[model samples]
Target: MSDSSTDNEASLHQYQDIQYSLKQSNRKTTSLFIERDGSVTVRAPLPYDMAKIESIIEQKRSWIYRNLAEWEDLNRVQVHREFVNGEGFLYLGRNYRLQLVDEQDEALVLKNGRFLLRRDHVDSGMEIFKNFYRTKGLDRINQRLTHFAPKMGVTFGSVRVMELQHRWASCTSKGDLNFHWRCLMAPLAVLDYIIIHELAHRLYRNHDAKFWDAVDKVLPDYQRHVSWLRHNGAGMGL
Candidate 1:
């Protein structure tokens, strides 16, 4: 739960007429983010005044522009997949070509270096692929959480894989974890980074210095995974 901006009740705001979305929470410090879709979001402390929030946003003006530009460049490769034969689908960061078949035991299956899809299932291809990712996401996220929770010295409640449109993962105050099924499209190393990020939230609710310190202890190289996701995330889609 990296405090990646959530759209829930986020109000439209502006600083010097620079439009952005504002999300206020109990966080101690204000932070800015360029979302995967290149939207500007500012997460501010609950008690902060509008003027103060505007000041921070003003301070980071240069950084915001640099990142938004990079986001544009990265998303240029955004994927638009079709259910037809020879179309490619992403699984674990690898692009596997889709092959339509008249007969298959399942709606979709990754077999022999390609994705085989039942031709009749093509109309429901989006849902079928979503189900495939969710099934795989649950298993892999659980396995990684089990392996890392002990190392991070934390216990969690239930874990679920679903459509988390904005963030890759989130955790409840009860310590239950929820991951975006799209996460299954990431490489193993990036998936682990997302796991550790949310699990660290069990120890600290905010992305403060101490919270990042916990993540760094486990994954000193985690920044590379972050870069990978920011650069390639747009292509991991239906």
Candidate 2:
């Protein structure tokens, strides 16, 4: 995939400097987010000026730099795993060891405190793990959405588990929800945070004050989960 993001840099307050990629969109208000690759992206409505863009980034300097540092620190550590006996795999916030079997009855299954995978699946351990997450995650995510959607005053559409690279979850404008299978690795509370985060988007589309206010209504301590994901997201992959 090629990134079409271009860098936008200008002067800042008190001799500080902010450089970011400006993505003009149909949305109202300016929204800034740091990408997984450590690039800054700012989305603003069209017909905006450079001075205005700089001011918006300036106002959120603390947030920008704080998350930038978090991004840098996240990529500093690496998580590697070999699909052998006693090797650990994360599921629903706990590490479960792989228990490979010599039967080809199925691709993957979790039973009796271990991830029971067929011996032939060893070569494609990543796919086996991904399948485990998708098959299991679909059930868990739907049940949770049914419980939380009513409180949000919104009816959720089809909830699917997939490979949503670079994002935890996404809610389509049409009311459907899609969650990354990797999200099944996080704790239940963190999973709820991801669910509530997307459901809130059905009401407020941007990360503005009103958008956060919607999220705060459900999960007041959402920041902790956000921090957890930011710091530990790199390790979530297989």
Candidate 3:
């Protein structure tokens, strides 16, 4: 609970641009977290010595290396689309290259197994693409929610579409279902699985056995879709 490092003679307290604190936990080991503002904090038991904790963190540098490598891999694979020619987009779990064209009206046309973005009249091609997908995505989700919510004997107050960074969909205690707009890229069955998963939460808030049982009552093979989302979710992000 006290600072034990006494190598410095200037002052007992050392000034670091980043300060580290050790927290007491029930776990046998320590963990480190780098905060958003570039501060590093280590969590460990209160009885542990500061010098030993620092040594342990140094010994676990391999974990830091692994995490940095994962971050770099995610950054490399997460592609951002510009809604321009040659940009790749996903529809129904398949990839298609965007082909931009000058036309009288803004439209999304599919031809020759490619998505054509006719963006002559649209002020912002990206906005047009987003709006188009939003509408279609909302429609599909609404249809699935309506069909599944009733079967699960759960009534939802509202369903809304928005962009979520961390989750594909979430359900609030008030019976509202919120889905990410990027879910449009998934297949209809996959989207339905997410909807059903959220709707079941209306009955059981946490992912307990009862919740999973409720989900299995509706979707017998929900694991496959869940696995697909977990593995390929990053590519769905903008």
**How many residue pairs collide in each prediction?**
1, 0, 0
Give residue 97's lDDT in candidate 3 (0 to 100): 88
Residue 121 deviation, candidate 2, in Å? Answer: 1.8
For model 1, the run of ten residues with the poorest summed lDDT: 66-75
For 67-174, candidate 2 gives per-residue lDDT tens digits of 453233333346778888888999999999988899857887788899888888799998878888998999999988988889999887888999864567878999
lDDT of 1 by residue, 1-238 (tens): 2244444457776676456887776668888777756688888775546777788888987556434432333234656788998988888878899999999898899999999999999999999999999998888889999999999999999999997645677789999999888789989998998899889999998665787789899999977777787667767777
Clashes of 3: 0
TM-score versus the correct structure, for each prediction = 0.72, 0.72, 0.66
After the best TM-score superposition of candidate 3, give how far the Cα of residue 236 lies from its true spot, in angstroms. 0.9
What clash count does candidate 1 reach? Answer: 1
Question: lDDT for each of the candidates?
Answer: 0.80, 0.76, 0.66
Global fold similarity of model 2 (TM-score): 0.72
* Residue pairs that clash (backbone atoms under 3 angstroms), model 2: none
